[model samples]
Target: MCRLTRLVACLLTLLFLVSCSSHSTQREAQPGLFLSSNNLPVFMSSPQVSFVLITKIQVPVQEGFDQEARLRNTLAVLTEMAAEVGANAIIVTNAEEFAAAYNRVSTGTHFLAGASFDLSPDAFKHVQLKAQAIYLNR
Candidate 1:
């Protein structure tokens, strides 16, 4: 009980510190309110085609990471991302080694981890890439 409490407190402190010292980036909090006019190729509506979610959340190895837990988190993030993009099915998605080099000092061990995802359609017609929920290209 005490250990759990300490861990929670530690996490809260870490979060507070991070929030206070986070690098700022400009993005509208609510996305998908309206069509974006970035002049990029994008589909307007959800399609019957499948999708794949790709995420590359890499971290330094100072904090120990369980491979199983990392995989689960990555999968969850992917699922949520896919769902947001009007996609229900995913294919050809996987994580690969980005880089891992660490030094084990007298204090602790450090390492690195990286992941990725790639999405593509099974087939398409007259469309570029036919991905990201491309429809009617069977």
Candidate 2:
């Protein structure tokens, strides 16, 4: 009974880590200017080049629990995504961190249901990043 319980505990830990993994989606490429939100207006309003929308990016952040890692990862992911889409710059429209209890035991149909029951804080926190993927006009 003791050995069986230990095995079960290990399996549960593995499952939880797997379920909390991060995910990212990439879009097609284009040529353009790459500008952060702070530098947007200067480059965007310039007559020499125009800002074009390549795609919007949304990704689940993994190191959200750690402040330093979260910040680094956020910037890295955005830069990577922009490069993937051949974007010279990325304008982050919204960046936020949120926590919510999620139900992880449901079937495919109801994968994410609001947590009605009390749950541990560590199990429900998540970070999400949303950005406007843009390219510069040649």
Candidate 3:
């Protein structure tokens, strides 16, 4: 019947639209100092190889994520940043995790009554990574 045909067309159109949507976290490389296809390696000092420091990179660690996954994500982000600056290698200088605290205050007015509350400070652990982006001449 006509209704069935219209319903099928609508569903097909909806499916097409959904399939065309892009993932929010997908990263696209921009044309920069180096080709994105080039795999960046972690630099290890050697007597024969020479490298030049391109720039330094630092990424704030995210809390509440799996340790391995967080490390992988950090590496990916660092690589992307380094690649943008034409670095062919990276040397991780520091990775440190420390305890941090922050205080939260809530204030509200209820029907002409003003109320203010100070919440106890919350403690959390934060990590930071520092690396040097370098270009190696081999």
Candidate 4:
């Protein structure tokens, strides 16, 4: 019985380790499509190549990600969204930063059988991206 218990414990530990592992997948840009911030591409403005606006998109900023990573993630998300709706290009219109409020929770072990919990309101930096998804006709 003791041997069986040890085997089960080992298996459970392995399972827990596997569950804790994380894998992140990044989206690849579609061919002939591009994402740009602010200015529209010069080629897009040419009379030879006309474009039509598909829809406007807004991506909420993700907390805990660095600025470069956030921009990459945002572009990936915008590209995916644009491709889903058959748009071939994305032009970022604006980026706005503001403070967001949330609740922060803290917990501690109080005596032997008791626990303590504290909750407070906190503010955090937040950003939002606005863009237009467009399809080009060349």
lDDT-superior candidate, 3 or 4: 3
How well is each residue in 23-132 modelled by candidate 3, as lDDT tens digits? 11222222235837249886433224777777777665433345555566666777777887777777776643211211111121111224224321111112445577
Q: Which window of 10 residues has the lowest lDDT sum in candidate 1? A: 122-131
Q: Model 4, range 1-138, lDDT digits (tens) per residue?
A: 999999999999999998653322223423344444333332212235576777767665444444456566666776676666566766676643312211111122222223234421121212455566677776
lDDT of residue 130 for candidate 1 = 14
Q: What is the TM-score of each predicted model, taking all chains together?
A: 0.27, 0.46, 0.50, 0.44
Candidate 1 Cα outliers beyond 4 Å, as residue runs: 1-65, 92-94, 98-138
Model 2 C-alpha lDDT versus the unseen true structure = 0.53
Order of models, best TM-score first: 3, 2, 4, 1
User: Each candidate: what lDDT?
Assistant: 0.31, 0.53, 0.54, 0.50
Local distance difference test, candidate 4: 0.50
Model 3 residue 13 distance off true place after TM-score fit, in angstroms: 47
**Error at 92, model 2, angstroms:** 0.8
lDDT of 1 by residue, 40-65 (tens): 23333444554333221222222225
Number of clashing residue pairs in every model?
A: 1, 6, 0, 0
